[model samples]
Target: MAASAYSDHPELCVKDNFKQSNFKRRIQVQCDLLKEDQCSAFTAISHSDKAIILSFRGSEEDEVTMEVVDAITVLPVTEFSGKAKVNQYFYDAFNDLWNAGIKNDFLSLKNANPGYELWVTGHSLGAAMASLAATTLVTTKIFPADKIKLVTFGQPRVGDKTYAELIDSIIPYAYRVIHKNDLVANIPPQFLYGYHHHKSEVWYNNDMTKGQPYLECDEDESKKCSDSVIDLSIPDHSMYYNVTGSFASNGCKGWNVFTQ
Candidate 1:
């Protein structure tokens, strides 16, 4: 579903793409696309898992999203309790997409599905939005925080220490999958801007080739994971598992490798 968001037309990626993917029979896209300020995502219903998968498209080749990717400044997570703060740009973009149409679409889907769980995933910029969505969805009573399952690749910091703590306390199944030396995962500088990552990090220390080992960090922001890398690379941000190249280049191929 994440790959589908990159297509020139929603049907090409959302419908046709899913037909060719591994989860074709198990999951189906209900909403082709949701967009506001280049923040794109889609809603998918999984019959086997009885869940709703909200997959956000990663960064675009535009300046507007690039600015938000900077991860500077902060905004309050109004739905979440306590003094939780997040990246102003990310929060706005998430809210923009959510308010534009995701709310109604999601609510309708949830009502139809009834007891379905919420699952969110993304990469790069989309990863940040996924985090915010997970938190907001919980605080708004859309889903019990514990029922929302989140697994994002190359996720960057979405909020401050308190917010990170909220995620740790709220969601037990959340996991941030950071490929070895993913530069995007290091942005917003923890020391400089005071942004912090949530708990449960799954760090791939190698090239993420088949048979390669990965570490489930013992710490929320474990230095022993990708943070220990001697060098970081931007290209690393684009590939996860067997999925490789830019979003357009993938053509929605190789998703089975990661989805499994």
Candidate 2:
């Protein structure tokens, strides 16, 4: 798929201001799932189209907590327990949200929308949750594996080789969008922890100007892909929609990019 096709959806998913009081003013349906110290997510029907979007929010004040969650390594998908495993923390967080009613709400919205498509997305931690949710939905038969469109920004590796193969085969339209030097995309380091990413990565160059190259690397764990490298700085991870003149202008604070 073209970069334009995948890029547009994530832009919409990450652009929301997330003001709870007036969330409906921004998106059609706002279903908030926040458990202090657990997980955070919201499901909304698009204001302009018939798409049901489930977006996850990254660590706000608990960076250390999220880091710990990332270190939990792989755990099997509850349904396919012995056969497939995913990042334990991401799956746990997503499981919390699913149990809290995202599944029912998602089905209700799908039935109401009739012909609308289902889109699952997020950035950083949200991206991880989105990946978990997308994969789980497929395994549970809540939604057809082929119908879910997943586009994540700054998403970390969410599973091992088996989990990656399962999702890559089931979700053909899954796109992992990584921007230049986005450090979050590189963790929990594949070499150190045996984590792996799904196929079809859309990598954007550091340049913000038009005509900058966006390459789609087909290898599942190639060094040519962004996740294979490590750069501690998080500026590029949060620069999907907003492009700063230079890294100095934003730096690690780029996490604020999506909200504005």
Candidate 3:
């Protein structure tokens, strides 16, 4: 597909006027895993369309932060226990993002384009937060039903079937792209509650460490999974977004879409 196929909507990629103090505040947060050596390297840059991109480097890897055009929310990931608290924390984090966008200064940017859509996305833990944030916005009617969407890479289950059902009932378009052999998504925290959820497509691959290029599943691999599952093994967990674009571009609308 041509690069022009993807609409460069203003709200999808907006920039933020970040100050030096924001970095200080990020470091001050005691519980945040983003803490590092002497200097706190976290930075939030707003895209022209209004979405905020937060980038930071940890001891071994780097992390990217996301904020939608109309919603400049942060992920409140304080704990990891499998409880309603995890759900509520995600809810609060998303609410904060919504509040950020509508705040006095943030409102000016949002009102500049009333037709803009709010989106949240991430990779790894960030992807998990994106899923939670999207669910919260839809459940609370924070944004239009179909207008909100989520694009996550290697996301895990947020809650039980009830939570998934709540998310499915409200959000019309949510896509979770899983790379082949990505063990993170397989953890299945929500499945423990008897809430079985599957992906729209499982982009698999032979080696994820190299480039993680995406590939369609062979006939044999697809049969190993039940009809309930779409085993994507192309990208092999790491390189889900290949040169051909991510799984989202291939039309995997997720379990929420087809079920409804």
Candidate 4:
């Protein structure tokens, strides 16, 4: 296809360009379980030539041990829940670590590579961190403000309506992925808040509407909501490898696949 021909059809051109650009990006992730004083934590950093994803798992238990348990305690939980105090602490922790990681990467890449894009993703608490990191990246101009994307899976409500809107405004590609019946999504942050203003969709399991956590209100908000959000219930709350697509796959195993 000629360049002029593509320019005439801008949407097609952009899609084609993104598809081609996906292969040029590099993928880098760091997973670590650390112990400090009386707490145990897990942190994972997944980056690509185009984007970056950082996740931190909370303590497995109240004891000081290095173990990554898949229980609710070990995952990231958003703020604005009934337990506001605990939620804020985790949110601040994720922000501090994420900012450090992003600053390191952004500074290192600033001189040699000036225009790389960015995206952040995570399952639960990780998802909330990813969203906040994405916003922070744009707000600080560490990455291209318009190029930042957020894909959160089964993320609890991070904040109220204003916070969600602030997040959405910083990046154009913010997307929150919800499963069909996953109860974690509805825990606290009700859907009416402004912070949940970004694009959202439901990921189905076997059937379209059978067994997954579903977000019913995003359609009325996002002008371009996807048909599905990719059901994360199949393998429990971990949808790390299922998201597939140039923008999503990032070479992950299952939940990373992009589903239309």
Top candidate, metric lDDT: 1
Per-residue lDDT tens digits for candidate 2, residues 1-260, read 11111231323323342222111111111222333454455556664555667766554434634454545544434335565666666677776767677677777777777776677877776688788888877877777876688988878888777778888888878888888877777777777456788877888766444556777887687678675455655667656645421222222233344233
After TM-score superposition, the amount by which residue 9's alpha carbon in candidate 4 deviates from its true location, in angstroms, is 42
Q: Model 4, 93-169: lDDT tens per residue?
A: 55556444545644454444446554455555556556666666665565776766566665656655556656655
RMSD of each: 5.1, 7.5, 12.0, 11.3
Clashes of each: 0, 0, 26, 32
Evaluation by lDDT, superior candidate among 1 and 4: 1
lDDT of 3 by residue, 85-191 (tens): 23332344334434443223323433454655555555544455566656554555545667665666655554455455555566666665656565445434333
Name every residue pair that clashes in candidate 2.
none
Candidate 2 lDDT trough over 10 residues, lowest sum: 21-30
Per-residue alpha-carbon lDDT of candidate 1 for residues 91-203, written as tens digits (9 for 90 to 100):
77777777766776777777887887888877777788889889888777778776688988888788878888888877788989988888888877788556888878898
Query: Using Cα atoms with residue i matched to residue i, what is each candidate's TM-score against the true structure?
Result: 0.82, 0.73, 0.49, 0.52
Model 4 deviation from the true structure expressed as Cα RMSD, one decimal place = 11.3
Note the Cα lDDT for every prediction shown.
0.69, 0.62, 0.38, 0.41
Best by TM-score: 1
Evaluated at residue 26, the lDDT of candidate 3 is 20
lDDT at 245, model 1? 24
| Error at 80, model 3, angstroms | 18
